[model samples]
Target: MSLRTTLRVKTPPGFRVDASALLPVRLAAMSVAEIERIVLPAGNDRCIVGDVFEVSRGEATPALEAPHAGATLVIENAAPWLDRVGARMTDGHLVVHGSTGDYSGFQMAGGVLRIEGDAGHFTACEMRGGRLTVTGHCGDFAAGALVGDMEGMTGGTLTIHGNVGARLADRMRRGLVLVGGNAGEFAASRLVAGTIGIAGQLGAHYAYGMRRGTLLLTQRPAQLPPTFTGGGRGFDVFWALLVRSLAGEIAPFSQWHAASLPTRYAGDLAVDGRGEILVVS
Candidate 1:
């Protein structure tokens, strides 16, 4: 049998809660009382986890780790103050059944985190590895650099099914970010490397200052910035391969594998100009 833990939010906090303490690694062996005694940040003071969450459990099972079977954490009626819900998790499964606050999966190295409702800012900041899915809209800086941080997501796959706010994937060095809806201003700005696929319209400065990376857009931008220029053909083979890869990731793009070539642009000449932006016809 698998062990499952559920944290039911009883009251919404007026201020934020640093929920990094709830990571699967930390909860692996804790008993009900111990889990409840965990400290959380509530505005200027500290509050016990018990004060806000009612804990419940399923059949007993082993701890959660990579490749290990069946351990789960579920947050029911999640509040916006619950930040960093699964930060730094190296393994296990987590589900937030409602809207979540900022830094939801900050720097997570591995595991799966699924948010069923809207996500606040910095949804997946500086993530190194893992799969994070947001079923609803996300605020600014999703999968982008944290304030003052040098880079954004370093590795992993972040899929958002709804609209994304500004600076999506900024300075991301590696990984894939897929947005099923529109992306805000400076999308993919200053990217060092990685792949970003957006199925809707882009805000201004779509690829501004981007140093490297591939951005796949299903729609055209209001205007292409001066830093970019056309990328001539000779990319047919690359296109074929990319479509095959993307087809498995986003169901809506399953037909992309047979679709015609998209218009390509290269540069952010202000930098290495090695990055590419492709817009589908």
Candidate 2:
């Protein structure tokens, strides 16, 4: 049989649900029916599965597992301000039909989060694992680190189809972020490791104080950090593999595989770093 859980909170004022705290652990080895029965917090009182949602049990179908396997969670029409629906989840698949609040996948370990609409700021802050794909635009710090923190995104992948706000990957340590449209200033500031690939132009000061990591651009950048030094020009097979791996998440980037080889630059010599920037020639 299949399992389904639908939220029933219609006009609950100021009632926010912290679904992230329950994920990965609660979703593992459980079916949809089992997921619906789990209790959800509502401010002061507790709510049961039948009280706040409508659940149906059936066999697993392609709709539920279209993106992947594991305990698939399909959230529909969650009102605005429902922040952190799936934070720190280690496994499972979470699908949201509408927009998501801030810190959608903060510190997530594994699993897949697909938001069909826009996402708020700090969308995937400090994400360690898993994959978060947003269809619409996002606010500032799309995949950045915590404020005043040195280490940014550690692991995982964040794919955005629409434009993103400022400081996309500031202080990123490890992981992969793919932006289909333009990005704001300081895109990869102080990036220690990992990669940030943008299919459009970077806003300004694209990479500043970047100690390590790779930033890929599809168009001619208006401005490049002075610290970065030109490394002549060369192609890397690893870039091809990265593009291939992200093809499904970012459809347009697939063309890079057949396009001309890009020019690579190494920089942040101010800190004696080894970060790199790759732009389409």
Candidate 3:
């Protein structure tokens, strides 16, 4: 039996609240109304509680019920530009009720973050662990490798239930990205190691400069890039496990686009590239 707490924003200019930085912070212990009483620094000034939003409380068992379960915090009509909704979160769960700004879960270490609405750019950039599940669309570089650094998302899972913008998973070294909807161009460009599964139509320049990784698409195009060679149709158990594990994490993935067996292709032949591309044959 998990407790529930709803903390509403009660301020006007919402300049001093970043609930994310206080993550692993428990709200269930506090009364529903008390949760809203919490205060923060508002840009070199102080403000009254409950001026910007409201709070509600309920219970959460295994799944977040939006009411109960200290597991979730409903961001009821929070102001835009509220970044880092779950930055560096190590444990617990977070659910966003509406659209969130950029870097929603930057560098998250562990735990689960479900965004019920759209998210701005760099949603899960450089995340090391945990799962970031988005019910709606996502901005550019949804799970891209960190800027300047070579590795991005070393562990964890990213599932976008809706369309995703450009540069998806750019230069990522590890982890997995499953796009249930269409993905913009340059998907998996310069990827080193990991898996990117795109269910809908892929944009142009797929796997650009990819050195080593796996890109799985539903379409069975006649030709691949000249740099790749067909590895023949085969059954991969790893893919089966991948789908099974992700299906529960990303519910939309329950819909299968192709058979369990798929054709595998290796390489962009541009770098030390041993990456493989699996397409539904």
Q: What is the C-alpha lDDT of each candidate?
A: 0.85, 0.75, 0.73
Per-residue error for 198 in candidate 1, Å, reads 1.0
When sorted by TM-score, best at the front, the candidate numbers are 1, 2, 3
* C-alpha TM-score for every candidate: 0.92, 0.84, 0.82
Give per-residue CA lDDT, model 3, range 42-138, as digits (tens).
Answer: 4566443465556666665466643322365556555455666788876667777777777778888887788888888888888888888888899
141 in model 3: Cα distance from truth in Å? 1.2
Candidate 3 scores a C-alpha RMSD against the true structure in Å of 3.7
Clash counts for the predictions, in order: 0, 7, 14
Q: How far off is residue 218 in model 2, in Å? A: 1.0
Runs of candidate 1 exceeding 4 Å displacement: 59-70
- List of clashing residue pairs for candidate 1: none
Across 119-161, the per-residue lDDT of candidate 1 in tens digits comes to: 9999899999999999999989888887788899999999999
Which prediction has the highest lDDT against the true structure? 1
Q: Please provide, for model 2 over 60-101, each residue's C-alpha lDDT reduced to its tens digit, 9 standing for 90 to 100.
A: 556655344446666666655667767887777777878877
